[model samples]
Target chain A: MDVDTDVTSGGGTARPWPIVDINPEALAALESYKKRDPSKVVVRFKAVGNAPIMKQNFYKITASNRFQAVIQFLRKELGWKAGDPLVPHTPPRFASPQLVLNKPQFTYINLAFSPAPDDTVSNLFKSFCTDGHLIVNYSTTAAWG
Target chain B: MSQYGTTRGPPQAAKDRTTDYHTALFRRLSWEGTVPLEIRVDPNELPANSDRGLACYFVQAPRVSYLPLLMPEIRRFLMDVVFDEAASKSLKEEDWWFEIDDGTLLKWHWPIGLIYDNHTILTTIRPGPSLATTSTTPLRLILHLASPPTDKLLLAANAEACKQAFMGQLKEADFIRWGNTKRMTGLRKADQDGLWEGIKEHNFEEYWRVASKVTPTTTANRPQSPGPPPSSVSMHGRPPSADTSAPPERDGAYNVRSVPVRLYLPDGPVIQDLVPPLLEDGSPHTLAHFLNTHAPLLFPPQPPAPPPSRTNPNPRPPSHQELAYPLVQGILAPLDSEMAWLGACLAGADGWVNVCVGISRK
Candidate 1:
């Protein structure tokens, strides 16, 4: 029933495959690993709902930049027209639509209203995002109250 | 002909007609998704011993269709009870459709159909017809219990008129201005009276005046820059390998960035002695990954000591310190993200913030 027993028992010495040892090579690499550039943070956007995905959804943004940077990028990609008299067909768009907070199992909390335009992406990301990249759901209309 | 000279009591048939109308209205609502809410009309408002004191109604029907059904009912009730025949007829022929708020904001508008659903409404106004109009006070409206079989109008105000009165003052623009603000968590229907009681007790004007202001950016656009060009380094679910062959991975490298964070022990012994001063990383490290890789440095498991040494027969019991490592839990707290960066977490503090690392309690 245990197929692994044959190969493992063939050798008189039966031990786990990974017999790790202390090596100086691993230690010498620590210095470079500790350092971080801090100037830029990468953003990977994934579309949710009926929102269209960008051709290139990945981009590096300055960590200090505000969340509006992402909003602005999304508006441009979607070809949304602002309230302009000349653009009569275009509807007036709210500067901030609902940005929902999502984690794997946690309830989908509506980041309703606040996290003002001035709030930095890095701060929001550190406060809410998961993994290295932030995943946000963008919609033309408010998804939740 | 009904009342020639003396004031005759309202016709007996009038009472029966009112009952018929109410019965029909309720039967229609039973089929709709929304539950018909009941409002206990004041005892004084109704005629002597009348059973029609309570008003049962719903807000599911849109203003366009609702006005036709509603306006006639109000007009008839006024003529029969409060007004004389001529006085009720002379009342202005105004449009009731325009009376309802047509706000595009989340709080002001709900899609029609599900008349009974757990809906959360947020607004900055007080809960009555008379709105407290001050530029600063934040208002919220929470309508809950849609799919969940909960009481209708579960909060303090249950009347259809009361809900509409709250909606009347909310402008769409005000919501757009406040939507991105991170300060207010607002009230919810599920939050038993405590949240409502707190809100009700506070004077909106006085609250705003006394509260320390954390300035909100009402209007501002993001600074424009040509966004980053596409890079070949795609981290599509695979672990990132160190750039060993290329130039040494240094602080100045394009991809390397540090999110410094402060960490501490909530219950375990002071961590400085147990772990290294700094942990090495290139890719982002989740709390689980960070602890797993550094297990040897942080919490090395002790092998059972070879029985009693012949030299010393008297064996001391293993100290409490030598016990197996307790299961550790990490928290970003306040900011409860799974993979929060060390640098971003530290950015607010002088250099780093003290995050606790302790045995998982729950």
Candidate 2:
């Protein structure tokens, strides 16, 4: 039996891995978001000091897309392998502030502020952005007070 | 009153009651009297030997008129009591200029209060009484010669009058519409539109384009060698246009609201030029917008001109016409992120902004 696989030999019962008990409210919210146009919402990202340039700075994310989408996309773009920490414990000199593979801090309009990880892209953008486009500044630390 | 609950009032009685209410409302709503405008001047401008009674006279601003209509009255007051013979003669020729705190020179027609109102200068000054006592306070407005005043008497008189007038007015400005007043309430939708076509059409174009000398007196007096550097890379040294005040014409439209910006490219000569207006709603004037719209204009395709001849090895860098945009990809980085806002980038008194541009990889 593979350790990664969820299985019990004694009872022969199958267990679903990474189980989430779905709620109706959350399901309704997702369904509503699906009906609306996703392109209307755009998130604009800017590279910090000495950060590696992003191939595409402006990304159109659906209203339902979570903050995790951004982190995952960044990880994929940076070609970070699995088991690589999102928040690097050790300081790496070659590490670009733009591609900070650590507890990255993000600011909206003001440099000092950061949004919660659970915030939906559309909601966050609508609240914090200008001209229906949210400009997100990413840095390894809170850049300004 | 007792029978009113049981039965409706007669038609004639009801009509009389309504008429009475309307008359009372009309009386209250009618213009009562002229509002007293405060005429604050720089107390320092007042002559030390002048009558103490002159201070009291300034406090009584000519009422029921805006600055334009009231200017004649003020001029008369100045000519009669304050101005010397030469100063009085200059008034007739319209050789004088009015300067606001921000170095904005104005003519007689432009309303003085509007500048004070828009900039919130007086309010900022009034709060800190300690700052008021300082001797080296910058005078708000002065009526000096077109050239620096040679006559000591006239200069002293001008200073005295300006200070006296400024202080008097600041003491008690009438409850005038400074910001977001009743008129603004009517313009709620227009304000949201942000371009303010109404404000644009207020026929302020003439006044806004007040043609005085470009260089300040202080700067003009400075030694030639140590003078301000020439805006070498700027496409338009001085724009070709009738209106001296406006930035320049762009795409057949006059960009009246532009500020002079010096675009510093990496290891390249700085391109100093007026940036076009940020759209009314404060959207679309981003770094991307500048690159897309202006970069092409600033850096058009370089013509396949022959290489620099051996004799003239140092051919000048690409002029505005010769430069090309396709190879030019760069990110504009202001010192601070807020400088990204077009307004903040160049709202300085000098109307100049220094922007750093880094070449971007395709």
Measured against the true two-chain complex, the DockQ scores of the candidates, in the order shown, are 0.02, 0.01
How would you encode candidate 2's per-residue C-alpha lDDT over A1-145 as one tens digit per residue? 3563322222323332221222233233223323533544777776565444555667776755655566556545444432355656733323444344553433333232333333356544533455667666666454431
Encode model 2's per-residue lDDT on B1-362: one tens digit a residue.
Answer: 22211111222331132222322232122111122233423355544443434432232221111333344566677656665566466444233344544444433322232232222322221222211122123234544334332221121223223322222121111001011122222333433123122122322222112200110111011111222212211222323432233222221111222333444332223333334333333332344445433444333334455568998776764543221111110112322222223322122111223343322111
Predicted chain A of candidate 2: TM-score: 0.50
lDDT of 2 at B191: 36
In model 1 chain B, the worst 10-residue window by lDDT is B116-125
User: Per-candidate TM vs. native?
Assistant: 0.22, 0.20
Each candidate: how many clashes?
32, 25
Best-fitting candidate, measured by TM-score?
Answer: 1
Per-residue lDDT of B43 in model 2: 50
**True lDDT of residue B217, candidate 1:** 16
